[model samples]
Target: MEDINRFGPELALLIAAGLIVVGDVTLPMRGGTRRVASVALGLAGLAVSALWSLVLIVADERGNAFDGLMVVDDFSLFFNFLFVGIAAVIILASVDLLEKSRFRAEYVALVLTSTVGMMLMASTVDLIAIFAALELQAISFYVLVAFLKDGRSSEAALKYLLLGAVSTALTLYGMAYLFGLSGSTNLNDIAAFVAGADSGTRPALVLAAVFLAAGLGFKMAVVPFQMWVPDVYQGAPTPVTAYLSVASKAAGFAVVMRVFVVALGHGLISSDWSNMFAAIAAISMTLGNVAALAQSDIKRMLGYSSIAQAGTFLIGLAAVAANDPQLLLGTSSVVFFLGTYAFTNLGAFIAIIAISNKIGSDQIGDYAGVARRSPWLAAGLTACLLSLTGIPPLAGFWGKFWVFNAAVRADLVWLALIGVLNSVISAYYYVGVVLKMYTQEPANDEAFQPSPYLGLAMTAAVVGLVAVGLYPAPLLDASESAAAVLG
Candidate 1:
């Protein structure tokens, strides 16, 4: 009973997904009616999961559950709120898009199902549990990527699945090495063994670290592993792209922190991985920003920009692995950055969905005179883009500030410098869109408003970002508390 109680949030979402499927089959509904019903059910389920997580936190109910396969703790709960919120927003954002499809219930159910996996990814402390949770998430994403059923969508999904399979194999091989070395699958047990492992075995540990980082890099959408990002982001439905940008990336970082910091940080091999992450951070930042500058499509541009953002996230991770006073700050900064980024990226995508649904094009040049077509949407997008650019008095600025501060504090001054330069480079493209929107003439002068659902979502995201920007202390404290659990 206690275990079940601790498992309430995930169980709630899983049950809701099943209910959505069963309800769709049993209910006498069709078309828009069915879509509305499905969206409502999906949102309801997410709300319940979020509320239950809050209840647990308030009740101070934190501990290992499912025989320690999963843990109900501050770290997992932080991600639980984030994942559930992203899923709910995606559902609301998809209401208009899903109306065109007959598989509304299936789509919503898959999203909920995938979210459950993400929650578990953050919750699990065992390597086997991590793999299982990741596969559950990846499978749902595979289907969702192809949900559009068009040629491009199919191609994107195929690339994702093929590349994902290779990454999975690499991840499993790495895990096998760890289990072989430690004779255990649990991260705590692995950490204990790693702390006492002989110096001669350092090469084997390095190999395992490389494989794990390379495999998980795909999920984080960082360089070298980011080949699928542009195509997948452009081909997948816009809502799915938004979910991938924020929730998927957050889950990847969460697990990476758990695996690297918790399981490996206590050993001499920590420096090896830290140096690797630092080098990757610089390369990903440079590559992602430079590539984004050449993109014409909005979705593709965001895809590459997401890579750059992921690199910035690595700044914190790199710092966290070091034995320094900034360790807690490093991990906490990443958590806070992820939180702020969720609202920032979701707002940008939601605004794009609103504009593109009417403009019928994803090209940057097509956004000319958008401020005239829809001033509010233009304003919302501008704020988000500026936030992405790391401008002050916005959520994005503080996220960058904290991570770079952590990097500098950890004595990774070179990585922090690279991050600053990349942020400057990113401003060019982000502001270019804003310039086109306000200064150029519209191709056509027919004004329109976003749908109420989209308007609501965009508003919520904008508000969340701005609110956090104005007063970030609560979130900072929460992130610090969450990161402390790792040690």
Candidate 2:
């Protein structure tokens, strides 16, 4: 019963996914009606799970299930809420776009199923379990990316599948090495082994870390391993792109923290991984920003932008590996930044969805005089872009502030400087979009309104963004508490 209770949230979501499938097959309904029904079912499941997670948080419930394969704690709970919330928002925002699809119920099922994997990724403590969770998520994404069945979507899914296979192999090979070194799969046991391992194991450990970093780097969309990002983001459905940007990346970082901070943060090789991540961070930021400067497509631009933001995230992860007094701050900064970013990035994409639904174009030039076309959408997108630029009194600003502060505190001043410069470089494009929206003349002045569902999603995201920006303490404190669990 205790084990079952610990698994409640996942179970609820899984049951809902199953029911969505069953109802889709069993019930007779039109495509549009079925999509609405599926969305309702999916949202109900997410709500139940989210409420249960809240109950656990309030009761201070914490425990390990499956003999420590999966753990329920503050860290996992934080991500649980985050993943569920992202899934709900994505579902809501996708309904209009997906209304005409024949298999919309399957779409919702895939989202719920993938979200379940993401939650497990944050909760699992065993290498085997982590691998399973990652695959569960990746496979669902493979299908989601191609769900549109258009030529571009098909090509993107193919590329994603190929690259994803390579990453999986790399991750598995690294896990093999770690198991060979530690003779265990459980993170706690592995940590115990790493603490006492002699100097001879250093070379093998470094190799393992390299492979692990490369594999996870694909999911996080960091440089060199980020070749697939622009193409995939451009080709996939916009709502899927939004979900990938926030929820998928967060899960990758969650696993990185687990494997790196929990299992490998012992005395040996700490500096090695820190230096590696710092180098990757610098390169990713510079490359991503430089590449984003020339992109004409909004989705492609955001794709490159996400790579740069992922690099900033690594700044905090690198700081966590510093093994200094700033460890807590570093981890918490990463968590808090992810939260704020969820609001900022999702708002940007949701607004884009609303705008593009009417304009029927993704080119940056198409956004000209959007303020005149749809004032609310222009304002929302502008606010999100400003946040992404790390402008003051906005959520993105505080996210960058905390991460950079953590970097400075951990003595990564050079890396922090690189981050700041990249942020400046990023502003050129982010603000360029804002400028085109407000300053340029409209090609045609046919004003349109966003659908009620889209308006609700955008309003919720923007409100969260502004609220978090004005008073960051709640998120900051929550992040710190979650980071403490890792500590």
Candidate 3:
């Protein structure tokens, strides 16, 4: 009964997914009615799942499920709420975008199912479980990216699929090496073996670390592994791109932190992985900001910006220390950042969806005079952009504050310095979008109204941003609690 209780949230969502599919086929609706029913069914399932997560959150008792392959802990519950909230928002933003799309029900089902995979990724304690969860998330995204059935969408899907295959192979090989060394797939057992391994085994461990980083790094969009981001972002539907930017990256970081911190954290080669991550962080931040400056398309620019954001978040991983009194600080910073980032990035994308729907173009110049067109969207975008630039008193600012503070506490001052400098470089591009919206001439003078769906989504994100910004203590405490259970 306890095991069943622990598995309740995932079970709720999986069953909901099946019902959504059945409703789509059996309903008597046609065209728009069918689409609306599909969305309603999807949202109902997500609501049930989220409410179940809340119950688990209140329970707060930690233990394992699925014969120890899955763990029900605060950390996993934190991500459960986070992923469900994200999927709900994505569905809200996607409904109108999909009004004309064929197979709309399947699209919503995939998103729901993908959220299930991400939640499992955070919940799992075994390597095989992790891989299965990751592939489930990736496969859904592959189809989501290509849903438009256009040449660009098809091309983007192909690139994403090809690269994803390579990443999966790397992850599998690395897991094999770890299993060979520890003679177990369990992360805690791997950590025990790694801590006592001899010099000869150290080289193998280092190789495994390299493979692990390369594989998981692809999902997070770190520098060398980031080639797929801009193209995929530019090609996919805007709402789907938003989902990729925040939710997908959050899952990647979740598993990365779990694997590295739990399995390889106490080994002799720990510093080797830390130093390598430090270098990757510096390069990814610098290059991502520089590359973003060259983009004229808003979606593509944000794509590069997401890569830079990943580097900042990576600092938390590099700072984790098993013996330190402030060990939770680094991991907690990531949880907090992801919370705020979900609001910040989603605000930006929802605005883009609303504005682009009106103006019918994604070029920066097309956004000129947006304040004159839609003051609500313009102001919302401004808040999110400045927040992303790390300005004070907004959600984004607090996010950077917590993470950099974590780094300093961990004695990673140099990494924090690089991150700060990169912030300045990013400001130039981020604010340039602002300048265009306010100062440049509008390509179209007439203002059009935004859809209510978009308006509601944008309002929710902005409200969350302000709420978190004004009172960060709740999220901070929640993050600390979530971080406490790491192996």
Candidate 4:
């Protein structure tokens, strides 16, 4: 019963995915009819899984399942709720995108399955389980990215797959080194070994850290590993890009928080590795923003912008000073950032979906007079854009505030300064679209109405953003609790 309870939420999603596939095969679904049915089935399954996850979290029945391979704790529960919500939002937003897909049922099923993998990534405490979960998520996304037969879609998927393979190999090699050094697969045992080991193994340990960071950086879209981001974001379906931006990045950070804090957080290792990530943070922000300024494609621009946002997120991890054994502020700041970013970025992508559905162009110049085309969408997107720019009284501002505060606490004031300057630089390009929408004449003056479902999703995201900005207490409280559990 304990094991079943610990695994209930994941089990629900797994069963739901199977049911979706079954419905697609069993029901009389054809073309557009099939797509609608898939959406309905996908939503039903996601709802059941989300409700199960909620019930499990409320029960507060934390434990290590599968002989300690998977731990059900406050930290995992927080990510569980986050993953479920992200999956639900992506499904809702993808309904419009599905109309253009060839295999709608498969697309929905892959998304749910990948989300399951992300949940497992959060839950598992074993290195083997972590690798398996990551591969599961990665494989699903590789297929999803290439779902459409557009010319660039194949190139994007191919590049993603090939590069992802190299990163996976690097991660696995690092895991092998760690396993050999520690002689244990469980993180607790590994941590105990690493913390107690002598100085002779420092080189091996540093190599392991570098390899792991490299692999995870690719998933998080950090600099140097981020060459594939712009092409993938621009070529793939917009909804998939949204999912990759938020959920994929969130999962990468989850694994990063888990591995670094749990297995290699000894004072000697923590201080050195923290500085390494801080350097990456500084570079990712500077390069992502500068590159974003040159892009004319809105999707590509946001893609580079995602890389910049990731840099700020790395600041959270980098701020986890070796002296802070409590693991409170820095990790919690990351949790808070991911939560707000999920809402704010998804809100922006939802707007792009609604707008592009009518305008059928991804160019920034094409967005001239978008406010006149659909006032609601333009307003919602403007709000999201301003939030991303870290304007006051919005969700994105608080995300930046907490992370920067963490940097100060960790004595990384210079990193915090760089972050602030980057935010200002980002503002110029981010608001350019807003200016285009409000000031420039429409390419074609056709006022298109948004679909009710997409509008609802955007409205929900925007509301969540504003509500969080107004009352950051709920998210902050949850983030702090989650961070406490990791240590």
Candidate 5:
């Protein structure tokens, strides 16, 4: 019972997956099966997440479970909750899309399984565990991205799989090198080994770090490594695109924070890897913003925006590696930024999906006269886009402010400047969408009726974003406390 309690959340998700499969096989019914399965899985996920939150509040902060493969520290607990929250939102927002597209029971099961993988990735402290969790998540996403069974979805899945395989291979090769050097797959052990390594061996350690960084960068959609993002986002189903944009990115960053801050803290600060991250930070920010300015497809533009956000996040990593005394603050800033990004991005995507469903297109021009057809959707989209543009009194503004402030405090003044400039550049394109929505005239005289479920979901996201933006003290405090555990 105690063992079960320890792994309850994961077990719950696993059971949810099982129930989905069993229900699909046994019931073999149509019409409402998809809805039933999706709701069941969503409820199970929410229950597990609630339990995990309760555990975080009641249980002691523990580390090193499963023979040191996992760690239930504050960092993991925080991110576990974040992923679960994102999953719940995705599930809720997807109901209308699934019904319209006639998705099967497998869709729910795969989403649950992928979420479980993400939770595991957040909690694991060993290299092997990270690899396993990553692959599990990747496989699920590969299928999810291609679930539409259309030519475009198929092409996206192929690109995702091929690139994802290469990234995994690179990550594994880097892990092997690290194992060879440190003689252990445990992060703690590797850190200890690197801490006492001779000068000659340090260069090889940096090389291994570079390789690992590259692999994780691919997942985060950082520049140069972000080649697959635009295609994948454009071709994948809208819900899958939202999942990839938020939950998957959060999982990647979770692993990055654990591996670097908790596992390799000492080694990274004392080695050349810090400079590498700094360089990557500079280049990624410049490239992502520049590319985003040229996009007309809404999803493709968001793909570039995602890459730019990743670059901003890299500044946090650079600060951590530099041993900036404000590491906790910096980490908290990143987490808060992610929360804000998720809400705004999801809200924007929700509106996009609603509009696309009505018009059957995702081009920027399709958003023209959105205000005339659906004022509520236009308002939601405007709020989201304004937030994403970092407008004051909105969620995105606070997120970027905190991150840039943290960067400045860490003495990365130039990085902060670059981040500010990028934010300004991003505003242009973000507002462009709003302009098209409000200024241009509608081509047809038809009223747009968004699905009630989707409208509710978008309202929730928008309200959450505004609430968080206006009152961020509570969330910031929680993030700070969670980040303190890494120390």
Candidate 6:
């Protein structure tokens, strides 16, 4: 029992993935077996997550684990639970979508495997562990993005693979440099070596760091490395799109936070990295918003929107480098924003999936007069869109407000101001979606019936958005504790 507890939540997901594969292959034929298998996998995942959370509550404060390859600190634990929760929600959301498509078993298995990969990424404190975990997630996503077996899906997967391979190679090369410099792959050892190194070695270390940053930046979809986002988001399945927007992005941030704050913060590296990140943040936000303004495809628009959000998260990272109290605030803000963003984005995709099933379109015009056809879905979408717009009393507003407040507190007042302006600019497009849903008359007054599962998913998301907007204290507090663990 203690040994099982030692492996903690990570084992649950791996076991669940294995169970899903075996059950799919061994189960006798039944009418709803596929759905049952998916549900069982989700339940198993949830159970593991709950147990892991309990461990976090009950376990001692010792953070290091797995021979210092991982850390079971509050920061990692927070994201561990978050990844599991998101995976569970995705599993629920995927049931209807998967049943309608072929390759149901493979989809469920891959998602579970991806969740496990993300969990490992969040917990690890070693560079080798980071690379292995990232590959685990990346390989699963390659299959997931191309699961549809369509030309567009194939193209998206190929593009993602080619780019991902390059990033991986770059990251590996960077790691080799660090390993050569420190003579160890352990993050703690690397930090100590950098702290003690002379000026002669600084340039090499900086170069390696730059390459590593670029590789991770691609994962976060930061500017100059975000070229693949719109196409991948537009071409992948809706559920995969949601997963990419939420789980994958969160995993990237987890690695960034650990790598920068814990590993690099103790080094002799100059403060120049902060300025570089500030520049990246500015470019990412401006470019993402500007590009999104022209997108007619809803998924592509959301993809660009996600890029802007990535910039905001980077602002949090920049704050950490400044050693400002705002780092705490920024960490909390990022966590809250990610939580609400997951719910809202997933809600929007749920609506899209439901409507697309009925109308077979992903164009913005297809959403016109959606309220008349499916009021429940339209209303849910309205809430999500409003949240995305950062409208008052919606979940997104508070997330943005906290994030900008952190930037201001960190004395990046200009960045905060720009973010606010971008938030306002975003409102135009989000409201356009809403107005099209409510004001325009449907070309055909055809009634739309939504799947019961999808309807329930949307309902839960709507409730989440409202509830989180009204009372953000609990989530904020949790994030605050998580941030302290990082410190």
Quote each prediction's TM-score. Answer: 0.99, 0.99, 0.98, 0.98, 0.96, 0.95
lDDT of 1: 0.94
The C-alpha lDDT values of all candidates are 0.94, 0.94, 0.88, 0.90, 0.82, 0.82
Better of 1 and 5 by TM-score: 1
User: Least accurate stretch of 10 residues (summed lDDT) in model 6?
Assistant: 265-274
Off by over 4 Å in 6: 1-4
Q: Per-residue CA lDDT of candidate 5, range 1-487, in tens?
A: 4445555677778788787777777775777765766676666766776686568558773656677787777777777777777777777777875775655567877888898898888888799999999999999999999989999999999999999999989888888888999999998888788777877886677777778888988888886799999999999999899999988998888887877776567753343655667677778878877898999899999988888888887887777766547778777887888888889899988888888989888899888898999999999989998998788898888888888888788788988898888888988898888999899998885887778778877988899889988998887887787778765
Clashes per candidate (backbone, < 3 Å): 0, 0, 0, 0, 0, 0
Better of 2 and 4 by lDDT: 2
> What is candidate 4's lDDT per residue for 195-309, written digit by digit as tens?
8988898899999989999998899999889999999999888889999999999999999999998899864578878989899999999999999999999999999999999
Q: Stretches of candidate 2 above 4 Å error?
A: none
Error of 6 at 403 (Å): 1.5
The candidate, 4 or 5, that scores higher on lDDT is 4
In model 4, which regions exceed 4 Å deviation? 30-33
| lDDT tens per residue, model 6, 1-487 | 4444645687877777777777777887564877776677766766776687576668664466767787777777778778877777677778876776757777887887898888888888899999999999999999999988899999999998999889989888888898988898888887778778888987888878788888888888898889999999999988898899889999988887777766666556635566677789888988898899899999999999899889887776776666545557767777778777877888888888888889889999988898998888888899998998888798888888888878888888898888888887888888899999999999788888777777877787788889989998887888888888766
Q: How many backbone clashes does candidate 2 have?
A: 0
Clashing pairs in 4: none
Model 2 RMSD in angstroms: 0.8
